[model samples]
Target: MTERHNAFFTDIAEATRLTQAGRLGEATALIQRSLGGANLSAEGARPTDASPAPHGTPRLEGPATRLDPEVDAAQATLIPERLRENIDHVMQGLRSLVPSLNGLTGGGQQAPGPNGTEPDGVASEGGQFVERSFSNAAGARDYKLFIPSPRSGPRPLLVMLHGCSQSPEDFAAGTRMNTLAEEEGVYVAYPRQTSRANAQKCWNWFEPGDQGREMGEAGIVAGLVRAICAEHSIDRSRIYIAGLSAGGAAAANIARAYPDLFAGLGVHSGLAAGCARDLSSALSAMRVGAPGAAEPGGAAGFGAGAVTQKLRVPTIVFHGEGDGTVHPRNADAVLAQAGIEALTPRQEGGINGRHSYTRTRYADDAGRIQVEAWSVQGAGHAWCGGSSAGSYTDPNGPDASRAMLDFFLSHSLTGGQG
Candidate 1:
């Protein structure tokens, strides 16, 4: 068979010779017919040995699969040696375009598990950064997972949803929340919303249609939470949710629906429930600039009326009193809608300036749950302690990262059947 295959090409070369030597017409007909025959015969021949068939015997065949010849050639010929080098070069070029991935300074790899004992190549723990995709009733979504080093037992999980126009990497860089995760020895997960849904990539929290139990945006966020809990050492009693702006609104929706999954929620310059019925309402609610804008509903059952469930999770609110977009008053309305009253104010100073806080504690039939509002004077609608490199962020506001961690650690969740 190998000989026959070689002979086929050999005959084509001879045909070329004939054409080159003035037998043009004959070479042309023979070339076309012979090429057709070779293709037909090649289909049934083994790749290892391209043999021809004997008389009265059909050629032996293997399963036929479609493939792209160029792709196959590239993988077979070009990819192996060049893949790593090309990736490095491309990543270097991308650093200029997307600088956040390169800005994170601290991440180290732990010692590999003694001699491949664990499966999935549990090599050294590198920064606790991991990612995967999952599908639910709605669709498939990508989720970034971060687990703290030295996992002794089940640890609390914190889900951080990024704000509008921010990716997982951007959020990680701006918040520097990974530093908190490493200190607390807890896992952190960030679920990214696609730009296709909203151009700004904001979570659709204003519409009642999206605030239900694991349905739309809330469902996708919860799906990532469930996936992380399944894959890592997660503490069910201490699961928490937090986000900024649009993400904060989405976090509220998640907490409202799956109170069992999250022990508390941390919101920054965000809208409360029932204020938005759609995108327009959501934008309006965020930009109204009125103090106490959070008190449930101004539009009759819009978001003013608190749900009977009492938003079982403890809450921490961060809003700049001088914010022009979402006013500090909206923070009041949010507290009112959640049925929490402000507590005494305390002051603290550190990286930026001294911050004042007002806390409210709520209790259901179970026990006591806390809700606090941190109103920073002169701050805008930006991340309180975000880095200066990013837009719409303030490095001088109160340190929300530390505050959220402390509040989340203090609370406990009730149910996990979901």
Candidate 2:
């Protein structure tokens, strides 16, 4: 690797190690120094009596948690060494807490995935929870795979990406995807994002470097999917992916980067691709969402000098009206990428004994539900209708897992979207 590239990975690892050691200030500071010294701070860690946005409320700012890591020569030059030194304290802290992902990193061939199955949750059902690793030009990360019991014909594949500070086991247990995967005879893959990649293990959804068709995190994830397809008898046409928070954002970007590979997508509490250009924009997007998502091109083709291909995969989005982290406005952004604004929506929903939701379905000329979105009232930044055994789950909300799977089964690569 070039000196600059090696330095990039090294700094990422060091920053993450510091954050894991309860040295967040040092972690972000380390990142600032590397990225020409911007700044990082933790403020607004309390709620206010302020009114929420008419559609989706801004995520309540709070104490700085582990921030994401993203970098590249292009991004380094975008923010000069002297920048952010004079910005307002709150904006300084907000921008400081997030990282970048300009497209100028990653360029390696993927090594074969050498792995084996181990016993876990679905073992009794004759299934296997296997741990594996995928390394390429970008970097190396571990991921877990849940293979259902031996079935007759080919089965579908669902790629599950976890949010920050979560593991495959934790996400699997909370989402309860394994049991459902076995019951439905599907294969579930949970890709791991290391602290070395981001202190909080957040997918670098805001990074331009990570958004490219075959570079950085996006490339690694796509490469892994290809490897799995080669090794397993996966129903190539029924492959799908989903995630929460940062992972949700990453899933959107990766699916867009590889439209022909994935048939459908599910994003829960995540922003659309290109919604963020940097740390400050990322914070604003999480709060009230970035502007221009509903414009002619949507976020996929928005941003300054960043023109992306229109999203093609069928998508299902879920967000809590009460979530204070990633706002509900972002859900609209995600739907905008589905390119279904012209289609008439069939809306039908109400409180399900626990939480009220507005489910909107958009159909094409052929009558296929091209887009599906759910907004749960009184829900926070947690997975809806998820099992309490795991973390960040709201059991009272609608069953998102079941609903997403059904959406995936209904679509396929052959005719997912035009």
Candidate 3:
């Protein structure tokens, strides 16, 4: 058996043994360790050439916690047939035990209401939540909008894209963006990815077709933004986009493709655009950061002799130093891709009450802050300073959403309407 598969079974066996011995904490830790890097295909393995589904296949809408068929096939091939049933049983046991363990460990449980709103008991007084949809030639996507009441005038719009396996409500509850929006009088838009496009509901950032302007998911999201702006009194110059994980990668892709559409970009736990062109390369980039020199043309096909004006939109990046899924080094790669230069030495300390972080500020020739990279100490592949109400959040890290908003609000498009 390959070492990867061996390690997987070994960890499972060890976790099961620990659970049987009543050492729940150790068992849980073992399970979490095993889960990390679990999706990686075996080294030197290539994905099978599976044909696309028929055009009439109904698109699945909702949370995507299940594995994709391609991923399942790859995983199934790794394990021996005899061990498959045992692995499944152990996983089921872990799933049952995790909730109880979480309760003991003070993990927050999400209480989702109808239409992805908070439970009725929880008051949503300050802002109004509305579900909206946008369609274009690229595709159609549903989104959740949080509009603060009593708007004095045109307010800034913040486009939030959720990570894989996350919903708009869950993302909002975790990031607490709605609360911030109410305080700052900002409009928040959350574009939801459908399972029809990606089984994991992740933006297809690795696909070349999705990396350009007016194309693929990026085009669809931009269309949604335009529709939102047209419908609401929004400051087109103050529009911004931010996201986490796969969504984070998509945010960068959008910013690069449509720099005129956003004032700034925020990427948290995401890879740089054009870092990978396929699943294997993407996995490698996530595991070891992007290899070789940074991509030329600024990740948006803005090569020399391009007719349209090109601008390096302001960017802010946050990464957990201990992120096993996307290495922290990817943050530097992103900064480099954006042509941001570090102006000062890295500073380390507990900026918040939670995790200590090493922060570095970058600026352009004009001395304006163009990029800021924060490496949160002792954090995992989760949203920093996020509420436990959502999945993949670490409450013990600096508030990324607030920081991104502050950065976004501080900058405006140099010369663009929308």
Candidate 4:
């Protein structure tokens, strides 16, 4: 192996030791330094020098989608067998320490059909699941809209974004949000990420162009929301957004870029807004959590001077203590960016205490919950309390869908202090 690969292995070993010794912060910093700053992509590619965009705008070249094989091959191939085993061992231990990184990346198992649908016994009998598409200046994208039957007046809308490699149907089945929406008399929308946008069908939450108001994916999604509101009798004040993993990260970006558009937000296994600008930093943020901040240049379409803001939307976060793909520490970083100084005493219980979790509520001085965090013990990257019919789900965990709905119902744009 070359000198750089040798150093990476050394850092990996040392990080493992530190993690075992319970010095996670030091290990994270060490790994960060060994990786050589933040311009690195997830696929181990370095960014080329490109002219910076106007202040508060994306780079002129946009985001890079693939890694350079010639540059990254050595790093990829030189990983010694022993070192690979050691890394796996370290990850297993870290999962125990973290508790939330339990499952492997992506949803756990695959279901059949285009939408990954199987008959769901728990799903409401008469709900409508309609496929729809919305377009704007940016582009057109497809989405699945679910409306519970027998709704009389305007209903709350919840936009659900799926993680990488997951479709709206898979997400709906996993989270069982549609069933819960039926019971709660809420409307649900699942916006799908296309392969043309991302090969893995993941939202480009890490891309600078996609992070701004009315710019890329965020803008497209916002347009979809407005169209939905116009067509359906949506309660604008009660509209909210939530997602898992990449979708969760995108939800954070959306809430940051368009705070007025959403009253509350839920992020599961997700990072905070502006936590990463490229794939490399995104991987780092997922592995070791980064401090959340807005990009330096203002987003193009929000207004002349409207920069991405620190999160002010009322929010709730759920992460596995052992989440290996996206570190559990990210939940804390999300709360910190929300300007939460302290949290209430944690309460513990889930599924009659069979699947234990710790919950803490962050409230404003007015005693309104601005943020809530749940750390599921022994849970992994999958959705806690999710169904097996869909991908990346942990049925034994508490019902995140139910909890999010309860939280969303309690807050609104005009009255709630998010």
Q: Output the number of the lDDT-best candidate.
A: 4
Provide the overall lDDT of each model, using Cα atoms, as 2-decimal numbers: 0.59, 0.70, 0.69, 0.72
Task: Sort the predicted structures by lDDT, highest score first.
Answer: 4, 2, 3, 1
In angstroms, give how far residue 277 of model 4 lies from its true place.
0.5
Of the two candidates 1 and 3, the one with more favorable TM-score, higher being better, is 3
Q: In terms of TM-score, how similar is model 4 to the real structure? A: 0.69
- RMSD (CA, Å), candidate 4 to true, equals 18.9
Candidate 1 per-residue lDDT, tens place, 175-226, comes to 7777778777878877766554554566667656567785666776787788
After superposition on all C-alphas, the RMSD of every candidate to the true structure, in Å, is 19.2, 15.5, 16.1, 18.9
Report the C-alpha displacement of residue 118, candidate 2, in angstroms: 13
Error of model 3, residue 21, in angstroms: 51
Misplaced by over 4 Å in model 2 are 1-124, 292-309, 415-418
Worst 10 residues of 1 by lDDT: 63-72
In candidate 3, the residue pairs with backbone N, CA or C atoms under 3 Å apart (3 or more residues apart, or in different chains) clash, namely none
- TM-score for all predictions? 0.63, 0.68, 0.67, 0.69
The local lDDT score (0 to 100) that residue 203 gets in candidate 3 is: 77
- Error (Å) of candidate 2 at residue 310 is 2.7
lDDT of 2 by residue, 264-345 (tens): 9999999886666556667878877644332222345444323244578899999999988888878877887777676679
